[model samples]
Every structure is written in C-alpha cells, then in structure tokens.
Target: SIASPWPLLGPGQSTQLIFGPSMDAAKLEEARMLLNGMDYSSQDEDGDTILHIYTAKGLRECAFAAAEKLRDLGRLDAKEHKGKTALLVAVTANQPEIVQDLLSLGADINACDVKGQTALHLAAHYGFPGVLQAILSGRPNVNLEARNFEGMTPLHCAAISHSVTTKALSATGLTDVHLQAKANEKLSCVQMLLNAGASLLSQEIKSNKTLLHLAVKEGNIDLVRYLLRIPLPNVKDFVNMKAHGHTALHMAAGLHGNPYQEEILQLLLSRGADPSIRNLENDQPAHLLQSGHQGEQVRLAARCTPPRGLSCVGKTQCIIYPATRIPAK
Candidate 1:
C-alpha cells in the first residue's frame, strides 16, 4: 500500500488507492478530473496521497506538477492519512529542490505528521541540513517538541548522525528555543550543545542511558575521557546500570575484538574502575579469561606469570633439573 494508485487513480471518493498490477493514465486522468470538478483538494487511503506516492516513488515531475496543482487548489498544506502533509515527504526523500518548490507554493513547514514531526524535524532526522535550513529560515516554532513514535524530539535525532560535526547542524541548534537536549552520541553534535551550556547530564526521554553508556557502546575513548573528566557517572547515573552492574570496563569486554583492551583496561583501572567487579555469575574480569593463549595473555596482564628466577617451564615457579649440574662426588 506504500506505492498505490500507480499510473492511474479511480474516482468516487474511495480511500483505496492501491490497485495492484499497474494503472492506466486515461483512468488516472478521469479520476483527476472528477476530483477537480468536486473541488476536492486530495485523496488518500488512511492518509497517503499523490504527493506521498510521487515523493516515495521518486516521480519528480509528477510530484512537482501535483505540488503546483495543490498550490492552485489552495491545498498545499493539506495533510494525507496521518496528518503528514506533502512537504514532510519531500524533505524525507532528500529532494531539496522539491522541498523549495513546495515551500514556495506555501506548503506548511510546520505541518506535523501523525507522529507530530514537522518538515524541519524530518529534514534533521534524515540529516539533510539543506532541507533543515530551508525549514528553519522560515522561523517556525523552534520550541515545538514534535515527537515521533519514540517520543524523541528533533534534537534527540541530531545526537546520532554526522551533522554533529557540521556547521549546518550547528545552525539549527541555535534556534531550538526549548534548549531541550545537551548531548547525543549518534550525531556527536551534543558536545557543541553542551559546550554552549546545553547541560551535560540532561535526562533522556525513554531509556536510562547516559552519555557514559553512549560513549562505552560507541567505544569513543576520547568521549569517555571527556565524560569522566566532567562528572564521573556511576550506576546511579542515567546510563544503563543493570545486567552486571557494569561500568565502561565491562562494556569494553562486550565490545567485539577490543584491540585496545590493554590501554582501555589501564585507563579504567587508573580511573578507579574495580577490576574485581563481578558479573551475574560472580565472575571477575580475571575469571572470564579462558585457558590457552588467551589465558596466558590474561595471566600476563594480571602479573600472574611464573617467578622468573625459578622456572618449571610455565608449569611451576621453580624447577630443579634433576640435579644435572649437581656435585660429581
């Protein structure tokens, strides 16, 4: 149903636009004429309309033409099945020129989809700063906390993508009237926000995760160091503290093939992370080491090697070679 009324649409006010096996232009034209005669602004099943269909299908010409028609009908702001206006779809598709065209036709930039996300939110969520810039320049409600299914705001979205390091992303941060978030790991943009006094420990909406967990999961030692320098979060902090009551060290072990295990271990130990911290099985980091080469490495790390002066060749700390060098008496 996501791609519906393809190549044709039928008249008679039916919300059912998805007819399988392709449609005919003559049929679509007849339907369009009916809708035009009825002064109907748009049609959709549930809420998807021609604009959504065109944007999703990348039918650029059709979409552009439909947008113009919507403008003519003064339905440029008309929402489809889920309160998703045409403009939101264009931004999500990364068609900036289309977005500009829609905006020029007075498509509502502040129009919210079913999830209460605006064009600006969608643009940011998709990491299209050009689209986001177009939306923000209009100076819509920056304080509007438009949420999605996850109840996350646009600032929350900004925390997870590359835009964190981009000037385009930074530009939008200036206009967030709510000053809602202070950090996000995915986008890495939260540092700038925090640097501007965006609050290093602002609360997350759904999860208990903090910047510590985010850094640990991402394995960004620099971020970990930065966070450690700030507050030194504990199990009580916002990040995940359950499962093993683990800290960043525990998380590092779970990280795949931790090449810098030694370095990370040293840092954590220096920072007061307890090496004897046990898991649910009551196993410490030492106990987690298995036998063989890995065991040897772990033993070496823990300074558990045999005494150097007396060697039983890894079996014993002291070895006497059967008195081979003993007296000839």
Candidate 2:
C-alpha cells in the first residue's frame, strides 16, 4: 500500500493534508475523502485554500468538488495570498468551465486581486473571450467600468492587452493565421463589453489615453477599423480626441517604422482625423511623417484628403481652421 501523504498526529495535535503539485488518481481519491473533513475556510502558508490549489493545478474534478463545498460554506470568494479568488484564478488560468461554475455558485464578479484586477479584467487582459462571455452571461451587474490599479476598465484592458501586442510583435506568415484568430477573440471581448455598455471613451488615469489611442499605438488595424465603424455622434471629435496633447493621428503618424502605420493613418484620415491638429511639440501629423519614400507617400495621402474645414494649398499643405473655433493645443 502506498503511504498516506497526510501524516498521523498524536492526541492534541492536528494533521494538515499535504498536497503535491499535480494530482493523480490516488491523490484525487484522497482529496475526495478529505473534502468533508477539511476546513474550507482554512488557508495554508501561502494563504491558498484547497480550492485555490485545485483550481490553480487544473484539477477539474477536485476543483468542482472544492468549489461546491466552498459555495455551501459561503466562502466562494475566498482569496489567496495575492487576493485572487477562485473565480479570478479560473479566469487567469483560462478555465472557462470553472469560471462559469464559480459564477453560477455565486463568486463575487467584481472582486479585485492585489493588483486591483477583477476576473473581467483578467479575462480581457489575457484575451480569453470565452471566459469573458461566461462572466458577462453569469452576472448582470458586473462592473464593466471597474478600474484596476491603473484605473483601466475591462474594455481598456482588452484594447491593448499583452496577448494582442505579442501577436502584433511576432507576426509572420504562419503566425499570421494565429494572429488573426487571436485578434478576432480580442475583438469579441471588446464587442461584448461594448454591447454590455462599457464606455469606449473612458480614459486611463495615468496617461488619459482612450481605447482609440491604445489601438492606434499598438498598430491594431482590426480594432481601429471596428472602433471607427461605430456610430458615434461625435465621430470626428472621437478621432481627434487628444491624450497628453496628442491625438490618435499623431500617434499613428509618428509610428515611424511600423508596417501598419500607413494603412492606419489612411483609416484615420478617411474618418476625419485632422492632420493639422498639433501635439505638445507643435508638430502636425503631416510634419511627423518619416522622411523618405514611405514618408512622402504618407504625406501625400494626408495632403490629398484634408479634414473638414481644412484645405490644401500650393506645395505646402496649410490649414484654415473653421470659425467654429479650433481646440486648444
């Protein structure tokens, strides 16, 4: 017989169940047997409960059992050392089924981890559209606008997520297929948040950058196209909205070597992005164009299609701001 992982304790001493990094059939049986006797509320040295361990280790059966027990004990939202609840862990680990189960069992949807990231924030940041859909479907009152430590909402997190950026950075012929799929997933999450009434214009606290600014900075053309297609009453203003004295056009224009910069610049210009709008450095989008053949192409593109209330002159493109009053620099 295999020796029990739990040690026998003498009278007046209690034995704590020791769990291995991975669970096998025997360990699963042992966990099932110990479930009733184990204290659902107790935390180990790392402040992780049996449920946390099971969820983190991807023990689906053990996690389900532990989560049910935790739910019955009204401790479903119990946090570990970093304040990550099981739901948060499930989302971070990409366990969509477990996330749905936890939500159905009443996990706190708006609970934030130590970094102030909620389950929604994690799902968005990690580009788990399935998990995000589950969270949105399970909870009606989810804080769509909930801000993390950086004051970024789930929409903001999805806009410039690390997953999206990674795909953008390492893109190639074979990876392009995967990148397109991942981009679709990110777009799904963004669309779900928008359908659920998340604010497209909400700016992060640190840089005051909106979703457009982030998408443009990352050279995410899909997101840029999708965002521009939305019917906003102030579409031009949305395109021209400034962050730190720089608009999305400025960011796209200054993307000197980015392969997607020219296409993105064209999209913004077609959407009424004013190239004449200057940043804090007093450089217009046309002025910021990279020098060379590529820069000349971008400059011609800008000059050919000036924004409303602006016109092109001989050789040099000058702007005549409308009497409606131009925005302060």
Candidate 3:
C-alpha cells in the first residue's frame, strides 16, 4: 500500500503528538513516514510550523528530523507567531541534540527572536554549556556579547543560572578549563564565559548592575571570591566601580539575612570596596549592615578612612556627619 505523502495532522492530533505524553519510536516513525514528503512550511493559527511544534515539545529525534526536512525545503528559520525560530525554541526547551542538529543544518545561531535573545542567550540562561559550545562552534560569528531585551549578555545569564553542568567541558576536550567544585555548577558556567572573554563589568540594561553585583547578591561566597580575583587591567578601579549608585559591597551588606553576606562584605572590603561610597539615597554600605557586630564594624573601619569631616560612629553604623548648618553657632 502507498503511504499518503501528507501527514495532514489535525490540530488535535498535532497537539497530542507535540505536547502529549511521549510516543515510542514506532509511533514517531509512523508520523515521520506520513510527513516525509509533506510541506512543513504551513503554519497553524499560532504561526508554529511542524518544526516549531516539535522543537517546543522537546521531541529530540522528531525535532532533528523535522528541522533537517524543513532546512531542505528552505523553511528552516521559520518563525513562530512570537518570532522564535526553531533553534531558539530548541534552546529554550533544553534539547541540546536538537540544537546540534539545527546548527548543523544551518539554522541561524545569532537570530534574536521577539525577546532579542539569540540561541546562545537561551543556552546560557538554561545552564547548557554543551549547547552553548555547540552553537559557538557551528557559528564562528556567534556574538558572545549578544544582549536580550534586558540588555543582559550570555555572561550575565550564565552568572545568574542556578547551576551549570561542566561535564560538557570535559566531553568537549577542555581539560585545562578550571571547574571549581566549591562554587558548583553556576560557577562553572561563569568560568566558561570568562574563559571565552566575556566582559564581567557589563551592566544590566535596567539596573546598571554588573555581573559581580549579581554574584554578590546571590550570596555565593566562592563566586564572589572568584570574581574578585579576575585580575583586571585596572583592578583597583574595577573594585571601586559603582553602578546605579550601588557597589558590590552595598549589595552584600544589604542582603537582609544572608549568612554569607558578612563574609562577602569582608572580601569586598579587603579588595578595596569604599565604605564611604553611598547610593542614590546617600546610604553607605556600613549603614546597610543589619548587625552591630563590633568586630565586623572595626574590620570595616580599618579598611576605610572617613571623609575629611566625617568620623566613624559606633558599631551600629559609621560615617558620622554634623547635622547642624554650622560647625559652631
């Protein structure tokens, strides 16, 4: 019997196959044979083609097969209603093998969807170092500094990941790459981006906060120490750098109850974080410390000298300035 060239999947059938429970190889092969000669360019009301549906559902082999077929038919980069390409969808779904196939089939690695995020951006956010490296290798022109709507680079996404798997580094033959167990997975991602020359000082679009600021706010003491030892050309300037009137020091001290905030604060201070630097509200980092630990306060005081007229206050807070209009009436 001759199989019909067109799959002609109804909306319900397509939804079931795309988003329903996993189908075995026999079912998948049946669907693939039916759609073997069908035009995959047709879009549903949502503007998602068969390829988009497969990628979104994270059907690995199905997505790869659909992507290659679509590529041969000149519809590889078809956008869903939201402007996300199959590559972007695959990355978001964390389908690394599908991502590999898409890249090999010549999907646009640098294509930013509606959110202005490229495949690399999504890979970084999802902590898929393997996917990131795959995209990077397939497209030598891939921009490491690509920014999304939030003005966040791949490096920023990596730094903010809950965890990053470094297994890819070893599998990809990156033995010399430093992977610190103390800092865990997210730290590995950050390290990979750093090794790739991602700028650590790049600020977030909205908050103007640097990657170091985010790491400190996360209360990752190991990440904080790693960032401090990055060895910049102008190390002192980098340490004293402020973003939106806040420094890493301020972020560490203001983290209401983070157990590591105090240790992070000391690390920042030892690296020359100026306690006198105030935010837009003119609150010094010392003022942000919730605890009145005399030992900690004395440690901070020793690192920072008061401004010309300002004097260090008790352990509660420092940087005392006269409230009166004149020194003497």
Candidate 4:
C-alpha cells in the first residue's frame, strides 16, 4: 500500500495507524511533507483542520512537523473560524514544544484570542509550569499585570493563593515584580510589592478604598498585618463620611471575619485613628463588637490589656475603638 491505512478517527481526529497510536506515529518529516501539500485554513464538517487536530491532540511531532513546513511557506499564520491560530491551538492542548516552534516562527506570544489573554496567560492560569517556562524564557514580564476578561492576572492564577505566591516570589528575589492590585482588588501581592517598594498608598480602579480595605475583606490576617506596618493612607471618603461612611475599622469589623483584628487595630491607633469615629448609621467599631458573644466587649478587652490598663473589653466595645481596619485589602 503506497499510503498506510487511515485510522478510523471521528471528527477532529488526526492519525489513524492500525498499530498503537504512539507506536505507529511516523517521522516528523512525513508530517512536514503532508503540510507542504495542504492548506491549513481548510476546516472540514467538524470545524477543524489538520493543524487544529494535530496541535489539539498534543501529537508532539505532528504539530511541530506541520507547523515547520507551513511556516516555511509563510502561511502558518492562518486563522480558524473561532479566531484561534495554530499556536493558540497548541497551547490549548498544552504542547510546549509545538508552542516553542510556533513562537520561533514569529507566532505572537502575546497574541490573544477574543478574550484578550495571551497563551502565556492561559498557561499560567492552568499551572502549566513547563509551557510557562518556555513562554517566559522569551522574556515575557512575569509582572506585566496582564489581565483577562475578568481582570485577573497570570500571577493571580499561578502558584497558590496570595500569601503562598508572595512567599514563593519573595524567596526568588523577584518580589519586586509582585502586583498589589488586579482589577482593583487589593491582594497579598500588595504588601509583597510594597515591601519590595510598590506604592503602598495606591487605590484600586473603581473603589477608593486603600489596600487595607481589600485585606480586611479577604480575612487574610497576615496581609492585614503587613499593611498596618506602614502608614495608613486614608481614603478621602472614609474620612469625610461621604462614601460608604465606614472607615477601614468598619470594614475590618465585618460580620464573618476577624483575622489580624488585634494588630490592625494597633496600627490604626498608632496612626491616630480615633476609636470614636462612627459610621454613616452612627454606629462605631464597638457597636460591631457588640454582635460578638458575651464579654466580647471593648471594656473586657481593655481590662485585659497589659498592666496600667484602666478600661475593660465592655468599656471599649461600644465606647472606644482600638483602631484598625483589618487591611491588605
């Protein structure tokens, strides 16, 4: 048989060797020849072509083989109906080598689909470190702050949560590249970035609240503690009672969270934060504490304060504010 028997593949299936799929694979050059004779833009009834099928299958040789040949003809830039290029297809399949080959051919590493996220973005989000390494080896800024349709960064998606990412990134001496805000949300990266010298006082896009506000919202005790070590860059509205009419204190004293409530209050107090500042509803931090269990009052807590403390948690709960908005928000 001049040509081997085709495998009985369904739509979008590329190879069909009667033998085992991996074992029956042909030399990369065979695919190169097939590529030289065909058009990649052609989509069959299944809406996929030879290039799409091979890359999507992660067929190591087949993807690079066809891409190498078509690239020589300068037509590898062909786009599919869904606007996915061959490189995008390869990435979707997690084929790193194919991605590298495509990138070498000038495939846009930053080429985004309709969603405005680069292949590197997707690679990072899915934790494909191998592919991401290949992508960043070309010097993609790990700190480019690239966002998807949802305004999240590749950093936000990679590693674990903000704290883990911060510790990992800090250990790498790449802490200088951490981001404080993504889509206007204060994050663990905020303090890491600040400690590495990011502006501690910067505000988010839609919200005027500082990073402290975000930290409090996440219930991240560590992040909240980290931000408090710096000066509290007060948000204008919070002081004027024009915005939410609640300070970071009001935010920190939220219903379900209490991480770093102690240290946060101290930082605020050291910064001259008044425990007496009331919210729009005329409620104070002590008022928020009232919702807690018996003896959870500020007076008891004040009494518990080290020697020479004259107040009690009850006295402080509804009267005086210890003063911190659990921040890193």
lDDT of each: 0.51, 0.75, 0.67, 0.51
Ranking by lDDT: 2, 3, 4, 1
Best by lDDT: 2
- The CA lDDT at 197 in model 1 is 34
For residues 17-59, what per-residue lDDT tens digits would candidate 1 score against the true structure?
Answer: 2212233466546555644554335475656667677766655
Any idea how many clashes model 1 has?
8
Question: Which 10-residue window of candidate 1 scores lowest in summed lDDT?
Answer: 1-10
lDDT per residue as tens, model 4, 160-214: 2454444454456653453322211223223223332334444443444445555
Worst 10 residues of 4 by lDDT: 1-10
lDDT of 3 by residue, 28-125 (tens): 68667867777766999988999898888877667766876788888899888888999988888876567767877888888988888888778777
Candidate 4 Cα outliers beyond 4 Å, as residue runs: 1-26, 44-49, 73-82, 140-143, 157-252, 255-290, 294-329
The candidate with the higher TM-score, 1 or 2, is 2
Q: How much lDDT does candidate 1 score?
A: 0.51
Judge candidate 3 against the unseen true structure and give its global Cα lDDT, from 0 to 1: 0.67
What are the per-model C-alpha RMSD values against the true structure?
A: 16.7, 12.1, 13.2, 14.0
**TM-score of every prediction relative to native:** 0.45, 0.78, 0.70, 0.52
Off by over 4 Å in 2: 1-34, 162-170, 174-179, 303-329
Q: Is candidate 2 or candidate 3 better by lDDT?
A: 2
Candidate 1 stretches with Cα past 4 Å from truth are 1-40, 53-74, 101-110, 115-121, 138-140, 143-146, 158-202, 210-212, 220-256, 259-329
